[model samples]
Target: MRIYNTRTRAKEDFESRLAGKVGIYACGPTVYNHIHIGNARTFLNFDMIRRYLAFAGYDVTFVQNITDVDDKIISQAKQEYGDELASGAMSPEEATQLVAQKYTDAFERAMSDLRMLPIEPPGAYAPRATEHIDGMIEMIALLIERGYAYEVGGDVYFEVRTFGDYGKLSGRSLDDMRAGERVVVDERKRDPMDFALWKSAKPGEPSWESPWGRGRPGWHIECSVMSAKYLGDSFDIHGGASDLIFPHHENEVAQSEAATGIRPFARIWMHAGLLNVNKEKMAKSLGNFTLLKDVLTQGYDANTIRMLMLGTHYRKPLDFSDSALDEARAKVERFANCFRDAEWAVRTADVSEPSEVSELARACDECETEFRAEMDDDFNTAGALGAIFELVAALNVLLKEKAGALPDADAADVRHAATVIEELAGVLGLKIRSNAKETAAHAGEQGRAALRLPDGSAIAPDEDSMSSLRDSATALGLTVEREEDLVLAVLDKRAEARAARDWAASDAIRDSLREAGLAVEDTPQGQRVTPILSSPRDLAHGSS
Candidate 1:
């Protein structure tokens, strides 16, 4: 397999240190708040990589750390407690832990909601940085002993100059670098680039006892220590968002190798590209920064989100917008319908075998071949997804011509086609057949609209047709928070208007909703409320 190594800045052949085992450590969230979409992109990419590696027949050991103690966590605690903390209502450590655990739970819930692969046998794979404080201290002590790190005034720093290969990963000469962001122009530092290994404890913050007194591990040190503990000092892959290529990962490279006396601490350095909204960096200050929970609770499908993300290569910038989600919804439905129809074709098989059956079997084989080729080339999820869709397209043709029931031999082809899609989708962690009945029903309902409300609930399509479309949408697996009530209230009013033969009132409600990016259509079965890609707030504004 070939992987794009961020450290080497080139796509290179990937070989596991052990014959059939691959160990990977992907940098995880800081848990200061609910993880935003940008953070989600990095995590999902790594999860995809891990899943693909396992699919490639390697025994993959994936470890991701939860940074429970951080500067941001402390700041959030101070902001939350304000005067209560000054009055000793709660200690800083208590507040820090509270924030950490709360957000950590939220992160876990979001990952489940997104259907990310849980690092199986979860213990060694998912470690909290706080739980590994001793490990960090031990690594820091080793770095100091090796003259790569030094302690001064209760704080320890990694001497950037001592390690001749310090800038090798980032390709920056020592003199050309500036340490303004994480490093300050401390008079005691031998050079401007010297970074803290252990930070001295400050007021209203969490601290631990180390060789250098009461202090906390630096941002970069925790990852180095955690990765080493779980995946050994040398492992197969190290991955995170591309933005971390600089001082964060570079310092990790320097300290991890310097302390262990090992070369190439991580063999393959994979970094997922950053996400953008309207070509601008997605930041909270920009107000366009979306939370994964927000998107999920707003009625977006998990597969739809994954479909939109995996449609792009991991190393390419992804643009996220409502319209993009709308487009991705169609592709997700197509996949869903293929699975549903293929199953239907298999169940109701004809007695006659057609010449097309052999062709379809061949197509399924070709799809798998193409999928592996794309994935083997730097984890090209976009191309791999295309390969699966091509197979789905071929299956759709067979299903269409057979009038939903293929001949006996072709029925086998139908099953083969569906299994191929499902297995390949699993490699991308797309969660196919996760809810088969719902998958088919969702595809049948043509549901593009989802309501977001205060409580996570969905809108029943309409009162009169509620039994039909509501069940169909629920089967489709669109999510929301308290949106069901508002959705029902408005659609219920329109339903009442229609029941009373009040055309004007019904048209008015439908028109307002249409303006809000919702399409209220009357199908042969019933009224269908579909989203046209606008957010729930937009719907509310239009209705008001």
Candidate 2:
């Protein structure tokens, strides 16, 4: 596999330090607040990378750190309550723990909704920054002893001049960066470009006893210490969003390498591109960022959000908008439907060995090759996703030609395609599952039973009741299907034809439905047909 190394600014063949084994450390969130969609993008991108590696038959150890202590957390807590000890006010420790757990739980829910697979076992080894203070202190002392860091007052800062290759990853010169130093002027630093390794703890804030006195770790040092402690002095890959290339990752390299005397802190440095909102960087300061919970509450599926992020290349900036998300939702729905249909065919179809099946298998293999090749080349997820879509389109054409008489081999190819897509997606932490008829049936029954009206009327619906409802609707010459929880009535026969996989018939049905103010969705349980309203309609009347 080939991956783009930030250090060289070029794609290179990936070789693990240990044969067939990979150790990867990704910079995780600083849990001061709920992570926004932009922050989640980085984790999703790396999850895909890790998943791909493991799918290719490698043992991968993925470690992502949680930065529990930071200036942001302290500042947020102070803003929430006037004083640390105010009655009913959350203390700094309590605030940090509460907010961190809440956001982490929120993040996990978002990941689960997106079907992301966890690389490590649940809570297996997610080391928090506050839990690894001693490691950070040791590294700092080593840097200071080597003259790579200097203590100014009670705080300690990494001396940028001492590290000659400081700007290698960012492709920035010290002088050029110094010119922009006025924006980040820290009077305590020896040079304008020098960044903090440790900050002196403020009064009534969290602190750890270190060689540099009572202080907390600097932003960059946290990752270095935690990563090195978990993955070793030199690991296979270190990844984060592209924004970390500067002082964050660059300083990590300096402190890690200077402390351990390792030529390169990590063999590969992978960075995903930033997410943009309305052609601008999404930042809290800009007041245009969308939180993960807010987006989920707005009724967008988590998988839809994941697909939206994956639609763009990992190394390219992605533009976020409702239109983009809607398009992504449509595609995801289509993919899910295709997989469902293929699985259904597999279970019901007769065994067959045909030349067409072999041809389709060849096509699937070629698609997988293209997908992996694109991924190997700098983790180009956009190209990889395009390859999967192309394969899905081809399978759709095959199903159309065969009229759902998919041969055994062709069915296997379809399954393989799904597996490959999911495996690659796993690298990005996307989970794709194909639910068969039995599971769908049970879920439909359970879901319907859970829906209760405010008036306490039991709307008990069985298959017979559903069939009666269908017949009643059909008497009006309307197509309909009754599932446990839903009454799917097709206002147009053409729409039913489409649901039955008759494209021509379905197209005609869609036009007729549109004329009759109806829209259709082919759900797992059954066809979901609804009337399109110009304005919102009350659910009590069931007219909408």
Q: What's the CA RMSD for each of the models?
A: 8.0, 9.6
Error of 1 at 309 (Å): 0.7
N/CA/C clash count, model 2:
10
Provide the overall lDDT of each model, using Cα atoms, as 2-decimal numbers: 0.78, 0.69
Per-residue lDDT of 265-300 in model 1, one digit per residue for the tens? 999898888889999878666787988876764556
lDDT for each residue of candidate 2 in 1-544, tens digit (9 for 90 to 100): 8888888888888889999889889888887777788887888888777777877778888888888788787776666654544664555577666666666666665555445666354322467888888888888888999999999888998998998888887889998888855656677778888888889888757777887788888889888888887788999999999988887898899888888898789988999888899899877778889876555534455556777888898888999887787687677777777766666666754434333456667667777788878877877777887887787787777777776566666666666655655665455544444321001011231333211111221222334444454454554465433342233243335446665888866665555444433345665544445434332113212463
As a whole number from 0 to 100, the lDDT of residue 63 in candidate 1 is 93
TM per prediction: 0.80, 0.76
Q: What is residue 80's positional error in candidate 1, in angstroms?
A: 1.5
Q: Which stretches of candidate 1 lie over 4 Å from their true place?
A: 120-124, 179-183, 285-287, 350-357, 434-544
| Best-matching candidate per TM-score | 1
Can you give the lDDT of residue 230 in candidate 1?
88
What's the count of clashing pairs in each model shown? 9, 10
